[model samples]
Target: MRPAMLIRLALLALLVAFIVTPETFAPVFQPFTKNGAPAIYTQTSLLSLTLSHLAIVAVATVAATLFSVGLAIIVTRPFGVEFLPLSRSIANIGQTFPPVAVLALAVPMFGFGPIPTLIALFLYGLLPIFENALTGLTNLPGNVSEAARGVGMTGRQRLTQVEFPLALPVILAGVRLSVVISLATATIGSTVAAKTLGEVIIAGLLSNNTAFVLQGGLVVGVLALLIHDAFVMFERSIARRTGRLY
Candidate 1:
């Protein structure tokens, strides 16, 4: 609705158009190639690569969200309170290790392709979601919680109806961070034979073709920016609906 958001949407549209029909702008990339060695990557369709890349990120992020949010909820419960440290440790393992390392470690068991990449991304995206969920679940206003208890609400009822609704915006903030991180990191999935935009960049790097690299990087960077902005808008809407924002 705002001018800035409209501008970003327009730019994203142009980038998506470029990815879909790169040959239309071959002349622009001509300078980046040598001896007319194809200014665009043609080994695989960039649109297909982009779609596959998104699919991988979507799947991984969903898995990470479920696991991390579940674990956070558990640790916030009375019976599971003592295991908070252990849960944090488990979530930290994902952030502590590099995605590449996770891929290398997973490849031996999962073999090449999207499986390893999914494992890497799923692990890499856990910490932010877990941390945010934990913070949201634990930091409720005391009086609001008391009101929930006073209303003949059981612990489960309070959690499902009162606590979680209040905590959703914060939890979604964590998910936004994880999704953006996973978007960038998912590029590395190409190294393990996964179909992604990284294939374009990797091909460029291998053949010393900057044009290919630029195409891949531009798409991924713009996609990340657009997704980040969308998440911000969604979070603000949620905050307003929850009366966290005036």
Candidate 2:
């Protein structure tokens, strides 16, 4: 196996160990404790919180990917070319406001829980995926696009069989960014009573438990790194098969 892959595996193993036996890792945080008690984040299951965190990010990222890619595809087509600016502006709408603000606004309508967080994450993740999709769809070499047309492929056929496949790596690059960002950002959902690793971090902050904060941050950071590396590997594999790189 590659060195990077080995490192990722090691990290995954360590994360699992920490989550499964958080008490074993308590000594590491003991020095950072404010109270005389042992520093361990035992109030909730670390594994469960981590799973909830992943679930929220996964849902939001998938939703963002679908919307962004669809809009990108629409705007790239001849009939939809006129709407490019409007689509872009719409995509940018999410980024123009902070996600916290979005959450604050959504809470009134969605009530406290994952719904508001979901909306905030979905919107926060849109711009990267949309921009990458736009770039991928628009940057195809002229001859490559012409060759698809020359083959008498229908618009749909050309798109599905040629353009989309060729553009997928670039689109996945955006997805990588979106997923990583969402994983880290989703922690904020805990502020509104949504279950996330942020709950640990917030508890730490509120009670001066540095251990809780560190544990939460460490888990989120490792998860992000692992997912980012996974996407990089995937993109590289696709690139190799497509002759995008030797």
Candidate 3:
């Protein structure tokens, strides 16, 4: 294995040992009576929540990818040049919005469920995905774009056949960012009865049990790491196939 891959494996193994053997640290953070079943308090509930949150991340990512790439193409055109700043502003606003507050506000209309949570996650995820895609596609060599035109490629054809493929690595990198943030933020959904790992963390805070909170926090961190690494590997694979990145 490559040195970097070996190092990552060692670190991941350490994390697994720490999480799976939480009892080993009992002397430090002893077992408090948690709300869930004893087994649930370990990793079972945490894992389930993380997986649910991944579904939320997937939805938000796909939506953002379509929106961003479409807007990038439109605004890059001569007739659409006036709208680039507007597109950028929208993306910036999405990033700047408070996801928790967004979820809370959305509760009144959406009626206290995963919808608000999904919306918040969607907003939080959209910006980076949109911006990075915009940057990635727009930053390519002008000559390449010109060559596409010289070959009688229509706008859609050039975007699909050339631009999107070239920009996919940056897009995937944005997705990794969105997934990590979504995983960490999904815990906020628990307040609105959203099924996420955040329930444990929130409950831990309410009951003032540091161990409970630590377990949830630790799980979220590890899940984010795993998701990020997985996406990055997937991104590298795609980029290599297209010869867009190494």
**184-207 per-residue lDDT for model 2 (tens digits):** 889999999889999999989988
Q: What is the lDDT of residue 62 in candidate 3?
A: 75
Q: Show the lowest summed lDDT stretch of 10 residues, model 1.
A: 237-246
- TM for candidate 1 is 0.97
Q: Rank by TM-score, descending?
A: 2, 1, 3
Global Cα RMSD, each model: 1.2, 1.2, 3.7
The per-model lDDT (C-alpha) reads 0.91, 0.91, 0.76
lDDT of 1 by residue, 1-246 (tens): 989978998988798789789899898888999766789999999889999999999999999999999999999999999999999999998889899999999999989999999998999999999999998899888999999988899999999998998888899999999989998999999999999999999999999999999989988999998998988888889888876652
Error of 1 at 102 (Å): 1.3
lDDT of 1: 0.91
lDDT of 1 at 239: 80
- Angstrom error at residue 235, model 2: 0.7
Worst 10 residues of 2 by lDDT: 237-246
Q: What is candidate 3's lDDT per residue for 63-154, written digit by digit as tens?
A: 76777767777887778889988888877766687987898689999897688888888778778887787788888778899999999999
